[model samples]
Target: MTVRPPQNLSSLSPNAAVDVLAAEIRMEKAISLERTGEAAAKAVAILNALPLDDPERPRLLAETAEAVWGYFIQRELMGQSSHGAVIRDLAIPREVLVRLGVRRMP
Candidate 1:
Protein backbone atom coordinates (compact mmCIF):
# COMPACT_ATOMS: atom_id res chain seq x y z
CA MET A 1 0.00 0.00 0.00
CA THR A 2 2.74 2.42 -0.86
CA VAL A 3 1.68 5.80 -2.09
CA ARG A 4 3.59 8.75 -3.52
CA PRO A 5 4.36 11.37 -0.92
CA PRO A 6 2.38 14.56 -1.07
CA GLN A 7 4.07 17.82 -1.99
CA ASN A 8 3.60 19.22 1.53
CA LEU A 9 5.35 16.40 3.34
CA SER A 10 6.28 18.70 6.23
CA SER A 11 6.94 16.08 8.93
CA LEU A 12 5.33 12.76 7.98
CA SER A 13 7.49 9.79 6.95
CA PRO A 14 7.00 8.42 3.49
CA ASN A 15 4.43 5.86 4.65
CA ALA A 16 3.03 7.50 7.78
CA ALA A 17 0.08 9.15 6.11
CA VAL A 18 -0.73 6.05 4.13
CA ASP A 19 -0.50 3.91 7.24
CA VAL A 20 -2.81 6.23 9.13
CA LEU A 21 -5.28 6.24 6.25
CA ALA A 22 -5.29 2.45 6.09
CA ALA A 23 -5.84 2.13 9.82
CA GLU A 24 -8.68 4.60 9.70
CA ILE A 25 -10.33 2.68 6.88
CA ARG A 26 -10.00 -0.56 8.82
CA MET A 27 -11.48 1.03 11.93
CA GLU A 28 -14.41 2.44 10.02
CA LYS A 29 -15.14 -0.93 8.43
CA ALA A 30 -14.95 -2.63 11.83
CA ILE A 31 -17.39 -0.11 13.24
CA SER A 32 -19.75 -0.67 10.34
CA LEU A 33 -19.65 -4.42 10.90
CA GLU A 34 -20.30 -4.02 14.62
CA ARG A 35 -23.26 -1.76 13.95
CA THR A 36 -24.80 -4.23 11.52
CA GLY A 37 -24.48 -7.00 14.07
CA GLU A 38 -26.14 -4.86 16.70
CA ALA A 39 -28.94 -3.92 14.32
CA ALA A 40 -29.64 -7.58 13.57
CA ALA A 41 -29.68 -8.40 17.26
CA LYS A 42 -32.15 -5.63 18.00
CA ALA A 43 -34.47 -6.69 15.20
CA VAL A 44 -34.38 -10.26 16.47
CA ALA A 45 -35.20 -9.16 19.99
CA ILE A 46 -38.12 -7.05 18.85
CA LEU A 47 -39.50 -9.80 16.69
CA ASN A 48 -39.17 -12.39 19.44
CA ALA A 49 -40.98 -10.21 21.95
CA LEU A 50 -43.89 -9.06 19.81
CA PRO A 51 -47.33 -10.51 20.53
CA LEU A 52 -48.97 -12.07 17.50
CA ASP A 53 -52.24 -10.18 17.86
CA ASP A 54 -51.25 -7.11 19.78
CA PRO A 55 -52.26 -3.75 18.39
CA GLU A 56 -48.63 -2.60 18.60
CA ARG A 57 -47.41 -5.50 16.50
CA PRO A 58 -47.66 -3.52 13.29
CA ARG A 59 -45.52 -0.70 14.60
CA LEU A 60 -42.98 -3.10 16.02
CA LEU A 61 -42.88 -5.03 12.76
CA ALA A 62 -42.11 -1.83 10.90
CA GLU A 63 -39.33 -1.04 13.30
CA THR A 64 -37.89 -4.49 12.88
CA ALA A 65 -38.06 -4.12 9.12
CA GLU A 66 -36.08 -0.90 9.22
CA ALA A 67 -33.44 -2.35 11.48
CA VAL A 68 -32.94 -5.39 9.26
CA TRP A 69 -32.89 -3.17 6.23
CA GLY A 70 -30.04 -1.14 7.69
CA TYR A 71 -28.23 -4.31 8.59
CA PHE A 72 -28.56 -5.62 5.04
CA ILE A 73 -27.30 -2.37 3.59
CA GLN A 74 -24.34 -2.31 5.94
CA ARG A 75 -23.52 -5.90 5.01
CA GLU A 76 -23.64 -5.02 1.35
CA LEU A 77 -21.35 -2.04 1.90
CA MET A 78 -18.88 -4.43 3.47
CA GLY A 79 -19.07 -6.68 0.42
CA GLN A 80 -21.37 -9.27 1.96
CA SER A 81 -24.11 -9.44 -0.62
CA SER A 82 -25.63 -12.77 0.44
CA HIS A 83 -28.31 -12.70 3.10
CA GLY A 84 -28.93 -16.43 3.43
CA ALA A 85 -26.51 -17.04 6.31
CA VAL A 86 -27.62 -14.00 8.25
CA ILE A 87 -31.30 -14.74 7.59
CA ARG A 88 -30.93 -18.27 8.96
CA ASP A 89 -28.77 -17.18 11.84
CA LEU A 90 -31.18 -14.49 12.90
CA ALA A 91 -34.25 -16.46 11.95
CA ILE A 92 -35.73 -13.26 10.59
CA PRO A 93 -39.41 -13.38 9.88
CA ARG A 94 -40.54 -13.32 6.29
CA GLU A 95 -43.19 -10.79 7.23
CA VAL A 96 -40.50 -8.38 8.32
CA LEU A 97 -38.23 -9.19 5.38
CA VAL A 98 -41.02 -8.47 2.91
CA ARG A 99 -41.23 -4.94 4.26
CA LEU A 100 -37.48 -4.28 4.27
CA GLY A 101 -36.32 -0.97 2.72
CA VAL A 102 -39.89 0.34 3.07
CA ARG A 103 -40.58 2.61 5.99
CA ARG A 104 -44.34 2.39 5.64
CA MET A 105 -46.15 -0.62 4.26
CA PRO A 106 -49.63 -0.09 2.84
Candidate 2:
Protein backbone atom coordinates (compact mmCIF):
# COMPACT_ATOMS: atom_id res chain seq x y z
CA MET A 1 0.00 0.00 0.00
CA THR A 2 1.38 3.32 -1.10
CA VAL A 3 0.99 6.22 1.32
CA ARG A 4 0.27 9.69 -0.03
CA PRO A 5 0.06 13.21 1.37
CA PRO A 6 -3.25 15.12 1.42
CA GLN A 7 -4.12 16.82 -1.87
CA ASN A 8 -5.00 20.04 -0.08
CA LEU A 9 -1.34 20.39 0.82
CA SER A 10 -1.01 22.12 -2.51
CA SER A 11 -2.45 25.19 -0.87
CA LEU A 12 0.99 25.76 0.69
CA SER A 13 3.88 27.54 -0.97
CA PRO A 14 5.41 25.54 -3.79
CA ASN A 15 8.62 24.88 -1.87
CA ALA A 16 6.77 23.95 1.30
CA ALA A 17 4.47 21.63 -0.58
CA VAL A 18 7.43 19.99 -2.24
CA ASP A 19 9.13 19.49 1.11
CA VAL A 20 5.99 17.89 2.53
CA LEU A 21 5.68 15.62 -0.49
CA ALA A 22 9.30 14.59 -0.17
CA ALA A 23 8.79 13.76 3.49
CA GLU A 24 5.70 11.73 2.64
CA ILE A 25 7.67 9.78 0.07
CA ARG A 26 10.33 9.05 2.64
CA MET A 27 7.67 7.99 5.10
CA GLU A 28 6.29 5.52 2.57
CA LYS A 29 9.76 4.14 2.01
CA ALA A 30 10.24 3.83 5.74
CA ILE A 31 7.02 1.88 6.04
CA SER A 32 8.21 -0.51 3.35
CA LEU A 33 11.53 -0.99 5.15
CA GLU A 34 9.77 -1.54 8.47
CA ARG A 35 7.87 -4.44 6.97
CA THR A 36 11.19 -6.25 6.66
CA GLY A 37 12.49 -5.12 10.04
CA GLU A 38 14.82 -2.52 8.55
CA ALA A 39 15.63 0.90 9.98
CA ALA A 40 13.92 4.14 8.83
CA ALA A 41 16.82 6.53 9.20
CA LYS A 42 16.19 8.16 5.83
CA ALA A 43 12.63 9.03 6.77
CA VAL A 44 13.79 10.50 10.06
CA ALA A 45 16.40 12.53 8.23
CA ILE A 46 13.84 13.88 5.78
CA LEU A 47 11.47 14.90 8.53
CA ASN A 48 14.25 16.44 10.59
CA ALA A 49 15.32 18.56 7.62
CA LEU A 50 11.97 20.38 7.53
CA PRO A 51 12.51 23.95 8.71
CA LEU A 52 10.85 24.80 12.03
CA ASP A 53 9.53 28.12 10.72
CA ASP A 54 8.09 26.68 7.53
CA PRO A 55 4.36 27.27 7.23
CA GLU A 56 3.70 23.62 6.50
CA ARG A 57 5.97 22.21 9.19
CA PRO A 58 3.21 21.30 11.57
CA ARG A 59 1.18 19.48 8.96
CA LEU A 60 4.16 17.65 7.59
CA LEU A 61 5.30 16.65 11.06
CA ALA A 62 1.84 15.38 11.94
CA GLU A 63 1.59 13.35 8.75
CA THR A 64 5.03 11.83 9.22
CA ALA A 65 4.29 11.07 12.86
CA GLU A 66 1.13 9.25 11.88
CA ALA A 67 3.01 7.19 9.32
CA VAL A 68 5.66 6.29 11.88
CA TRP A 69 3.00 5.27 14.38
CA GLY A 70 1.30 3.15 11.77
CA TYR A 71 4.54 1.34 11.06
CA PHE A 72 5.18 0.85 14.75
CA ILE A 73 1.73 -0.67 15.23
CA GLN A 74 2.20 -2.97 12.28
CA ARG A 75 5.56 -4.14 13.60
CA GLU A 76 4.07 -4.73 17.01
CA LEU A 77 1.25 -6.77 15.54
CA MET A 78 3.72 -8.86 13.59
CA GLY A 79 5.90 -9.45 16.67
CA GLN A 80 8.88 -7.67 15.16
CA SER A 81 10.48 -6.53 18.37
CA SER A 82 13.71 -4.99 17.09
CA HIS A 83 12.04 -3.13 14.27
CA GLY A 84 9.37 -1.76 16.59
CA ALA A 85 12.10 -0.55 18.92
CA VAL A 86 13.76 1.30 16.08
CA ILE A 87 10.51 3.00 15.16
CA ARG A 88 9.90 3.95 18.76
CA ASP A 89 13.34 5.51 18.98
CA LEU A 90 12.55 7.65 15.94
CA ALA A 91 9.28 8.94 17.35
CA ILE A 92 8.45 12.61 16.92
CA PRO A 93 9.46 14.77 19.85
CA ARG A 94 6.85 16.14 22.25
CA GLU A 95 7.54 19.68 20.96
CA VAL A 96 6.43 18.56 17.52
CA LEU A 97 3.23 17.17 18.98
CA VAL A 98 2.56 20.48 20.64
CA ARG A 99 3.19 22.24 17.37
CA LEU A 100 0.66 19.91 15.79
CA GLY A 101 -1.92 21.17 18.29
CA VAL A 102 -1.99 17.98 20.31
CA ARG A 103 -2.15 19.41 23.80
CA ARG A 104 -2.19 16.01 25.35
CA MET A 105 -2.99 12.36 24.77
CA PRO A 106 -4.03 9.61 27.09
C-alpha TM-score for every candidate: 0.79, 0.43
Lowest summed lDDT window (length 10), candidate 2: 97-106
Against the correct fold, how does model 1 do in TM-score? 0.79
Candidate 2 structure quality by residue, lDDT tens digits, 1-106:
9654467984787778889878887787666756533333444556788787989776667655555555555665655646435635666455543443333243
Off by over 4 Å in 2: 1-43, 81-84, 87-92, 95-106
Off by more than 4 A, model 1:
1-11
The whole-model lDDT of each prediction reads 0.83, 0.58
lDDT value for candidate 1? 0.83
Q: Number of the top candidate by lDDT?
A: 1
Query: How accurate locally is residue 96 in candidate 2, as Cα lDDT from 0 to 100?
Result: 43
In terms of lDDT, the poorest run of 10 residues in model 1 is 2-11
